[model samples]
Target: MAGAGEPGREGSGQEPLLVFRTMMRRLRAECPWKREQTHRSLSRYLLEEAHETLEAVDALAAAEDAGDPRRRDAAASHLREELGDLLLQVYFHAAVAEEHGDFDLDDVASGLAEKMVRRNPHVFGPDPVAHDDATSVDDAWQRIKAEERPRAALLDGVPATLPALLLADKALDRLARAGRPVEDLDPDDLGDRLLGLVAEARAAGADPEQALRDAVRRRV
Candidate 1:
């Protein structure tokens, strides 16, 4: 006999997730502010949480590089908390969608699982190919992703809202992957010069975004 609040009641031993899901559902039902939120209203929070999570990750990495065990441990805990906050944004969005009859959290998770399985044929598909390195696996993943969107226009998937340096980096990378050549831009134009710098960073195996952030941090 299944009892209320039993672990078995939550499928597959995901009791914590189920409990949080229930909490979100209840919040949406009972909280006046939560009840009034639309997807548009919640969008800013999702971006803020994502950036907070990234900051947490950078803190952890910095702590590790400094070889401070105590700082690393604290940073690790902070990162975990930030990750949970980011995850709550997902649940919040899913809750909103569930109310609108769009989709539930389970549908969102299932779609992500299906996409991962489809993209990593070297691991999930039959007769798995032995990838020589991470680069090979990544190449295969990118190739499969491109193949899936055969009719998509060039630059179709790149989000325009990305930071200028990162946006230029991704655009150049996408063109390179597609075997398309970009025409040289006017050297005198500041924006074009910055784009050229992004291309240089890529050729040098550096992240232009991280490099710029680090430069600013050093100056500060």
Candidate 2:
């Protein structure tokens, strides 16, 4: 099995991604469900696939810890299938856009490649990284991204669809990084207070969800 991000040999000069796109094209033309799918309609499956991929990750970790190659392989296979489904969602959306005379998959790939180079200054730019310092590298990444995509507000770009704890944590982190204080919003209910506590945890550099889970587990 090829590890993640490892390049594979081209199949007789046929680019694997292009081949996959061609397969997607055929499916769009022949498959009734695929033909009927729009970007909006496929959103639910995209979310489901992402969650399933996360589940596969957890299973793979457990399999590896158990030192069972067979179980690990099974977990890897499940992950691959889920990832393929997710990839299909990308291709499906791009195909729909292409049919409407908008941008296609090539544009998507090209833009991502350009962004990768533009963002990774330590690797692709003049400021090369001499030693691999993961922490410092991440700081550079966030700095570069901040400059590339400036937002008017600190938490303006945070995704609303993210898990509530994650969203709260991210928003709080952004506010803290920007030297902005989190105003003590009046809690209307227990949920709001929990969210506020999550933000407080982020401010204090703690994991609120893990802390809560640990506390609950002690009672069990």
Candidate 3:
């Protein structure tokens, strides 16, 4: 095992990802806390790290908007740290699985790369797809996904545990894609009204979840 600062075995080039995976494996073996963690146990940390990364993204955007070079640099560093923390969750889960003879980080990464190549026919396939714009590209991607999971329900892969606003946004998007868009709005009912707002946000090309978070932040 290589020490933190010492790059081990000259002439054997070290990739950061492989090094990180090795570090995670060692942590799982030697660290008491990491040793005890299961996939179920690490779920909360994963979620928390994801949200922290989001916050770091917002901060970086704000710093850029403010035109502060120093602030932007600091924000970028914070975002990178947050991203690394989130990635730790991934490697942690992979290490846990590797221990049980399930899967490892390489398996997870390879599957993702394969999925991206499979989905983006315009970029990687033998017969390239012609997409005029981002919307068309997204449409093509969704179509490929649908074909891959034939006979799946509209909400089959949509997690019910998503934030209410985001859940409504995805549900509405699915309905619109299926040509069963929710045209009827009920202002009197809170849920329907909120869904309507989410639809409006979607049309305006905004993230309702982040918009609401910003609004609440301004209020407090």
Candidate 4:
């Protein structure tokens, strides 16, 4: 039996997206500051938004750990604001590209959806050697990624601009997955062991940066 109203209760379900796109276009044309900006000029704002979002995530994580509903709600509210700021940066970029007749938000979204379907063959296409193990999925994902983009080196895409710790984590993970050999550097002390611990965390499907950040928040 069908529900009330129309067969499709929602009226096209694209009105909100259309509204957002219209708003972005109007802002691009009418706003003086927005009119003057280019994608290169907005790069810093994108980075700033990303860092603010991460800060909010950290705060939310800490609040969740403390088991305080009030604090959690407050953090969630702040996080939502940060996410909106971040999303605006994305839409702003899309609007800028659209002005030049290059591409728009739809192109960005379509490319991402296409990439996800291509990479996650197990879920979108066929369940190739299905297993609940995360490591297996990760391994297959890396292999498929390598095939999708032929890299000159295993570390080709590991951006040097990434924070030092994150770059290390990526390099380690890529080398390990690619079966590339690394020089056996001896761990001489406690600091070296901490480096090894980061690798262990990656192997266990944990984010070392977030883990340390959470630990600091909990303890200090």
Best by TM-score: 3
Residue clash pairs of candidate 1: none
Comparing 1 and 3 on lDDT, the stronger one: 3
Residues 63-158, model 3: lDDT tens digits:
998899999999999999999999899899999998999987779989999999999989999999788899999998899999988746889899
Model 4: per-residue Cα lDDT over 18-52, one tens digit each: 66777778778878999999999999999999999
lDDT of candidate 2 over 1-220, digit per residue (tens) = 5443223332335777786777677778878988998889999988888878876776787688789999999999998988888888899899988888899999999999999998787788887775367757777778888998998877677888777777777877787678886776678878778778887786576877656654764576
Index of the highest-lDDT prediction: 3
Off by over 4 Å in 4: 1-14, 126-129, 181-183, 188-194
> 1-220, model 1: which lDDT tens digit per residue?
5565443564445678887898789889988999999899999999999999988988898899899999999999999999999999999999999999999999999999999999988889987889999878988988888888873667688889998888898888888887885667879999888888888898898999999986876687
Candidate 1 wrong stretches, greater than 4 Å: 1-14
Query: Clashing pairs in model 2?
Result: none
RMSD of 2: 6.3
By the TM-score metric, which is better: model 3 or model 4?
3
lDDT of 1 at 103: 100
Worst 10 residues of 4 by lDDT: 2-11
* Clash counts for the predictions, in order: 0, 0, 0, 0
Tell me the lDDT of candidate 4.
0.82
lDDT of 4 at 15: 79
| lDDT ranking of the models | 3, 1, 4, 2
| Cand. 2 Cα-lDDT | 0.78
True-vs-predicted CA distance for residue 216, candidate 4, Å: 3.6
Alpha-carbon deviation at 173 in model 3, angstroms:
0.6
Clash pairs, candidate 3, are none
User: Distance (Å) between predicted and true CA of 40, model 3?
Assistant: 0.2
